[model samples]
Target: MNPKATRWAKSVAMVATILAVSSCDVLPRSGPTKREIYAGSVQREGDAFVIAVNDRVTRATAVIPALGFSDSFRNAGAVAADVIRPGDTLSLTIWENVDEGLLASEGVNFTSLDSVQVDGAGFIFVPYAGRIRAAGNSPEAIRRIITEKLQDQTPDPQVEVRREAGDGATVTLIGAIAGTGVYPIERPTLRLSGMLAAAGGVAVAPESAQITVIRGNQRSTIWFQDLFDDPRYDIALRNGDRILIEEDTRSFTVLGATGAQSVIDFESQTLSGIEAIAQAGGLQANAADPTGVFVFRNEAEEVAAQVLGRNDLIGAQRMVYVLDLTQPNGMFMARDFLIRDGDLLYVTEAPFTQWDKTIAALTGSLGSVNALSTLAGQ
Candidate 1:
């Protein structure tokens, strides 16, 4: 071999060896493994970080309630029962046994009245009936009240009340919908999901969407998937309710030795750690360390304080959670582990993968040097 080629070969091997040695020290090899993190070692202590595998998460969840539908479904039953309110418009028709009646013409027995808007006092002004209370009563109930009041003025008076628009009882469908408009609550059974369908279904897949309900002073949100999976979330919409279908911006990033590295949108408002891994195409089988799957997230202040076993972690941020899929129990735990919005899921490369990559790189460099030496001899 040429002296220069030999020197090149030696230099390439030296560089590869240094790279391999440096790579191993980049991550700790002995202190703890994925199983340890999975088994309750989450905390922020000095320079170390870990997660607890027990009741801590449940407690945190209790403090921070699930967003959207779960919190807002309590009013579904009452909202489903439609009731008239101020700002409602109604059309009244009056009929009398004789041509000479108060509401009907002098020669006519029937009269179709004009539409009237309910006043702020929840009353509608009628010609002879005066101001009739209409709010808080259903259309049928309002009609009965008007008929009873008209009996004195007409001989056997018959009254019909038809609602033109329940101004206060409408749901405005907005954002990421096939159609956006104010949908009147004709019936009490108009549910959250039903309204979505009536508005020409969803413009985007619900899996990656969130449904927000904005009522008078209350606003809540729920994952589209969760809304469909549980019938309880399909709550009835009320008047002046605004339903918004928006794409959930929450995401989790997969890093390190995964089949692919990308930010995955939470198809639903809630996602499990396992599901996140699956979305990332799972860890690279050959390069992954089965015991090093980890999820990083910023926990609530209280939860962070508890996990770190410290009293002063008021606003601590970011902690690591590990899952060891090599064990059967690990798979079960992963399913229970919920991945929050803005989380990071990483699967460390197997320890030897570093050495393999380093060796391959060195071999390529040496091959080029050898080829050059051979060509010089030729």
Candidate 2:
């Protein structure tokens, strides 16, 4: 061979050797070892920080009377609606023979009498009495009005009114509760806890559930924890009052280089990335890559890749933040970065060291296949 061609061939051989050696170090020998990929792909999710079992969350407890009237009883006069519910028995009797005496029987057994139903129109049907407004009127007031109308035909007739079977009172329970339906309010006043207890309390996930009160089109949210904290928020439920329990949908999941991988729930409207990391029990000592910490999230079109280096964040307005485990001051910055739901955090390992084992395995497999083919051909 010519000297120049021989030199060129030697240079090519050197370059090929370098590339082959580098590939061996770069590619993992094992089929993409799970531990290696997990170390790089895992991230913290959600806003709220996770507390230890020994750590006590700030909570309040108060002793409330089991059956005492709530302060809302003062505004009872303002309520003007009523509805008959199950488990309540109402008795209806007519005075003398003015209206055919529906309730009065000498020997005949009657399944139904002249009982009035507070129907959809908020009125009750009485025999020969037509539709009379019974809703919003007390039992005594209804009796007085009926007596006045019958006074002309009967001489000093006695009128009897009693709730024998159905009391015109009901409460509706909706949202994040095990049983969401119309529950009967046996008594006049029902406390917030009493209603929850009647409906099997809040749903299984009480921490992520909220209660809403819908009365006369006015809606108000009541936090389960807050209801336990503040007595003022615990309201007295009235007839026809609706209690809705709403389940919280916002949450974050922590994976990869975190000490603990768990789904963290965010009750607040917003959560920071740094806060999410801390809630995940900080980063693992061996797997955490302080310089290569990144958050992989889906943007409008492409995946938004944000790098959080140790010195990148300086202000609070920026959503992305990098944490430095080596420095004490970085702890404060980690606390500042808010985490959002579905946000993924990845800590990359040092290059060349990651897939060395995988590449070696692949190369060995290729070499074995080539040798097997050569042998078979021979």
TM-score of every prediction relative to native: 0.70, 0.54
Q: Report RMSD (Å) for each prediction in the order shown.
A: 6.0, 10.5
The parts of candidate 1 lying over 4 Å away from their true place are: 1-65, 68-84, 99-108, 119-155, 177-179, 189-209, 222-238, 312-314, 372-378
Residue 148, model 1: lDDT of 82
Best by lDDT, which number? 1
Clashes of 1: 8
Model 2 C-alpha RMSD vs. true structure (Å) is 10.5
CA lDDT of each prediction against the hidden true structure: 0.72, 0.52
lDDT of 1 at 68: 55
By summed lDDT, which 10 consecutive residues of candidate 2 come out lowest? 52-61
lDDT of 1 by residue, 155-211 (tens): 788888877766767889999999999987765337776777778877887677778
| Local accuracy of candidate 2 as per-residue lDDT tens digits, 1-378 | 566755565556555544665564454332223333334432544331212111011110011112222344324442322333333444566646434444445553222444554665556655544566665566677667667765665555566655533444667888778788887664433566777887788874666577777777666675576677777665666667888787766676665566776677775544555667767787666555554454443322111212322333333312222335445655444444445556565544434434444456556755665565445445
Worst 10 residues of 1 by lDDT: 27-36
